[model samples]
Target chain A: MVMSCRDRVLAAINQETLDRPPVAVFTTCDTIGMMKASGASWPEAHSDPQKMATLGCAQADYFGLESVRAGFCLTEEAEALGCPIDMGTSHSSPMLKGHRNKYDPMKKIYDEPNDLPDIDVFLNTKRVKTTIEAMKIMKKTHGEKYCVVGGNTGPFTLCGHLLNTENLVYSVWTDPKEAQKWVAAIAPYCKAFGQALLDAGADIVQMSEPSASTDILAPSDFPIQSGQFVKHALGDLTGHTILHICGDSAPIIPFMFDTGVTGISVEEKVPPEKAVKIANKRGALVGNVGCAMPLYKGTPQEVAKAARASRDAGFNVISAGCGVPIGTPDDNIRALVKAITG
Target chain B: MNDKKLLKELADSVVACDPNRARIASEEALKEGIDPVEAINKGLVIGMGVIGNDYAEHKIYLPQVLVAAHSMYEGLNVLLPAIPKGDLSDAKTAITAVVQGDVHDIGKNIVKTMLTAGGYIVNDLGKDVTPSSIANTAKETSVNVVCLSTLMTPTMDSMQEAVKLINDNGYHKNCIITIGGPPTSEKFAKEIGADHRDDDAQSCVKYVNSKMKKEVK
Candidate 1:
């Protein structure tokens, strides 16, 4: 019997043999062509659950992407947390406006350990509600056939946005106990948010924690700061959980597995030989494809070649290294999908 | 304290990321009539060198590096005023900013701080900076390099636009454009007409050092 898209993705995440390897993208599926075709433009699409759902569904319904991912921008969680946001253009993700914590304190955003924004406020925000609605719509329309992937700001990245990135880093050094407390406070929210995504009908929840990557943070700090928070935040997911971090994560791959996620999504910078070997011992390996050069700028043939190479090397599921860029050619995305399905 | 011991203390304070210690060391050096150039070179810069290497090697991470930079800044605010105005003539002047449509600045901040530690006179334009402003700043400051950073792929075009504005404004003749960030690459840099693209702040500093022959005061 032919496996459904949902089965294919679940099988891949569970490391089961597939009719063929499943192709998935853990990043945003929004593209200019996708937006134009689905009649879902950003700024509006970012706010309107209907438009956002259309853009996400177009991934599976339109481009043959196995997983339809939503929450196009990373700023949604920050917006809910009280950061002023600029919903970017049709081609861009929304970004946090001026530094929110620059007003009252110099050393930190929250003067006291308990001063962090209430988790209830974040859950009730319009953006979060819209995202939940979008996930529901995707699950309703395509969940039976395709995997509906939902995510929000992971703790480290969200903290980076809340307190200025520099201030957060400084506080982590100057007052580690306080920093840990702040992160601990955010952990429950992270769990609640991920649970909300799953409750909204997502089969897999991706904790996109790029800030915790080895590229940006010290490898030593990963297990302590980001690793601990991620473990606390998404450890109890009823559905499969995928942890996606940007940049060369070879050094921290083992630590990522220790977080107890079902799968790990790494970018092209990590050597496939290493990722495959390490992932075999830990969990399912999702990606090692270049998102920019081959997947976005290179021809379909190049993308297919890249995908085939990743699959041949033991990557259970083929995926883009990072979020698919806005202007990435439709054929490039199709090349990835076709490489697996065909 | 002897000049050597005092300078070592200054360097140690920064490596420890101790602002109060750094400030106190700077004051002691000033009271001892130690030359400001020696204090910055033998003390502040030396400490940053260690921090930079630790960061590059992953022996230390963002928090340590950021706090160390802050400590250096605390020391420099005391020592810099004492340096003779003309002593920095050979130092290259550079401007750094996160490109328009992108609010990410941690990479840009690291580059700016590292460049300063490398003895460059860096003017940070902060985040969400416009291409016109980048070009205008280059023209106004007569800088040797303009460093742009963007983590968002959508803002990659803004890097190209900034390069175009710099070239159109004729600042390209004097100012070399460099782009850094996750999505930026050598191909993207060349495609955008940028002169160079470095993987990190340290590499950018080395690139600028080789090109400008920055005097290590």
Candidate 2:
């Protein structure tokens, strides 16, 4: 019997024997081909749930990726929390331009933790509302066939977004306690937003904490700066949770498991054999594809070869280690799916 | 205050990430009549060099690097204005900007910091800078080098555009165009007709500094 995408993904997360290894892309995979196919792209896709759903569906619908996730960018939480956004063009994801308090938005948050934007205000923001609506649409359309994944910025990254990333990084050393408090303050909001994503019918919720990667945060500090806060933000979600840290994360893979996530997704920096060995003791593993290198620069044949190597190396769910670059060709994505299916 | 001792203390202050100590060391170097430029290169830049090396090796992370850069800025703020204008008038100028449509500037910012720390007069055009703006700034500043940065592949076309614009502006012959970021490579640099691409800030500093030396000779 053929397993549904939802079942295959959940089985991988639960470490159950599967009919076949699941293939998914945890973060943004909306290529320009996807945009053209849906007639929905960024800037507009960012604001319109219908367009967002249409673009998001193209991944699973057209390319045969087992999972589909909406909200193609990480700016939702920041924009909701009062950061001014530059709604980018068809090729670029929206970006946070500035905060409400030009001088020190983060300082303002730290000074008045109680005065941070209310939960109601966060939910009412344009992007958040539409993001939830997009998830709902995906669930309605592809609920039985594919896994509908949704995500929010993990606590540390969310704090980094609200405050400037530079300030947030410095604060981790200079003011560890306040930095923890700042992230802790937003944990509830992240949890609430994640639960909303589930309510909208997502099977798995991913928390991308690229800021907490070993490239940015010391591996030794991962437990507090990332692991504990990830738990704080996502502990209450009813669905399975996946954690993604953007760079080579081998050293902190064990600590990441301690956060109670069902799976950990990694970039190409972590060797597939190493990821498998680490996950054998921890949890499910996903990804090691080079999103920018071969997928963006090389041919579909290269992507297929990488996909086969990643599969043989024991990635539980085959995927690109980072978000699929916006310029990644459609043929490459199709090749990725074909390699796994073959 | 022996010059070598004062410079050592200045470097130590920055490595320790103590802005107050950096400021104090800079003041003492000035009071002792040390050449501010020498103090900056020998002291502050040395500290940043240590920070840069640590970052490249993954021994230090973003938090430590950010703090170290802040400390260096504190020291530079004291020394930069005191130097006579004509004394460093021959300093090589470089224009740096994030390619158009790419707002990710952390890598570019770090590169700018290291370039400035390496004694280059850097004109930072900030984020989402267009190709025409970068080419225009290069022409107006009469810069010896132009560095383009972008974190996303979709926006890399803008890096090529900036290169073409620089050539169109007649600055290509004199200016060394370089691109840096995670997605960029030496092959991509060559394909776009750029002079160099290095993922690390220190290498970028080394490249420009070496070119500056050759030009002077």
Candidate 3:
């Protein structure tokens, strides 16, 4: 009845033999209610390596999440890139409002990347450094046990977060070539970022691109600007590469596979069968869990039902389709683990 | 310029979301002395209404809706200014949010904007809205309708809970409560006694029109 949660998840990751598909209890901050119930705290994880690893391990121990992602958002990189975050109620990641405000459409757009942002995010920032150190610590704590996943905003997504998609979409249409230049810059950064994660002992490197999803851009738009750079980033990435995009990504999913993403994680809006078809034709299918279901209001039993559906649907890893919502219930976390294990 | 073909063309412009074309279309209708209301009702409003439906059905996305609504508004801008604003008794008022225990704000924001451009005055109760707060807003704002949203299935019960409170408070008497989001459906709304259910922002306008016309029992 009891086996190592880490092994179950890693087996799925390796695409090896498995009793049941591994379910990742997505590590978005637990809901206020659940946090209060578990008596858990944050800022400790954000600031301390040991506490952060403890936080990461706690989710796995409690819920049987096969994989543990950094849980930090892309705003971390944007913040280093000179964007100030609103520090909204919960971990408000910074946004690049300044550059976006007077963005000129006709001018040559460049990702305008520099090593400075990377240095700050990876070495200087207390929170950033602490996050990396935590991964190292979690590696020591559970590395031999489970797969530690690392996430970063895809370059295009980071750019969207910077310039705001309101204008970003316009730029995509008007200055397509300039946009490519901007996207190209992020590829090296993404590659570097992924490398940093792998070096930190992450078994999986998750890179989500909000800009490439069909919900955002058409398939016709993929080949030129966004998809090419992603292909570049994917080629250089070590370990398993996961491409996470929001919404129904059925149309552009094939292109995602063409880039050789080791796996694809999608939201509930995207049918699991579609992803399964794609995965069957290509690589591993990671998820399509309703972020709100287990992470918000659903009980352990409901989580089990959802997991059973995922198992039936052929999802290799049970993961929320999107980032876990803030304040998700702990029992629900227990339920998510139960779903994967039971 | 007030050609019917031109007006229809203008309406199509709204659907394509080209405000300049929409403006040209609206001006032609007015110059031809078309009944401003009829021009709006038949030309721009009806077309944009379709986009909202398309959005609900996932036939169209947020960007398309934004463009279509923007086009409709440009047409409205041409007409609203030209004609002495008459009482368009068809105005709808909606209170929307992501519901409590949820923090997603984009879907609610897009839907609200579309509804507002559709001539519905919307009060965004903001993300993570509690049921009691939603009920209170309905009571206090004299809102014509309550629109509850949640992108998560777990928070869906919150929508049901909000709808129940509205009924319990007798706020459902004349007011139509509409709910939609990633997990919501028309059928789900009916199961919970919600007066209206739309998964997309566009269809709600038509539903709103139907509700406004219904006689109070």
What residue pairs are clashing in model 3? A30-A327, A31-A327, A31-A328, A32-A327, A85-A94, A111-A182, B2-B28, B52-B202, B56-B200
Give the lDDT ranking, best first. Answer: 2, 1, 3
Second chain only: TM-score per model? 0.94, 0.95, 0.75
Model 1 Cα lDDT, one tens digit per residue, A1-342: 878878988988898876677888877768887887788888798889998888888887778878888888788887887789888777667878854454122344465545656777778787887888888998998888989999776787787787666676667666766667667777788888888989989988888898887776778778877889998887567778999999999888989989899988899888777789867647888886787778777899999988988898889788888888888889898988898788
Worst 10 residues of 3 chain A by lDDT: A87-96
Query: DockQ for model 2?
Result: 0.70
Using TM-score as the measure, name the better of candidate 2 and candidate 3.
2
**Across all candidates, what is each one's fraction of true contacts kept?**
0.70, 0.75, 0.09
Q: Residues A32-76, candidate 3: write the lDDT tens digits.
A: 443344344453444556655666666566555676656455556
User: Could you give the CAPRI-style class of model 1?
Assistant: medium
Predicted candidate 3 versus true structure: per-residue lDDT over B103-194, tens digit per residue: 55556766776676566767888877889999888977777877778755556777788888888887788687887776666667787898
Best by lDDT: 2
Report the C-alpha lDDT of model 2 over B9-126, residue by residue, as the tens digit. Answer: 9999989988789989999999999999998999999999999888888888878887888889889999999999998888878888999888778788888889988888888999
For candidate 1, the C-alpha RMSD (Å) to the true structure equals 2.4
After the best TM-score superposition of candidate 3, give how far the Cα of residue A242 lies from its true spot, in angstroms.
1.5
Candidate 3, CAPRI quality class derived from DockQ: incorrect
DockQ of each: 0.67, 0.70, 0.19
DockQ of 1: 0.67
The order by descending TM-score is 2, 1, 3
- Between candidates 1 and 3, the TM-score winner: 1
Off by over 4 Å in 3: A1-8, A26-40, A72-74, A86-123, A170-182, A185-188, A210-212, A219-225, A270-274, B53-61, B95-106, B113-141, B150-174, B183-197, B215-217
Candidate 1 regions exceeding 4 Å error are A99-110, A113-120, B86-90, B214-217
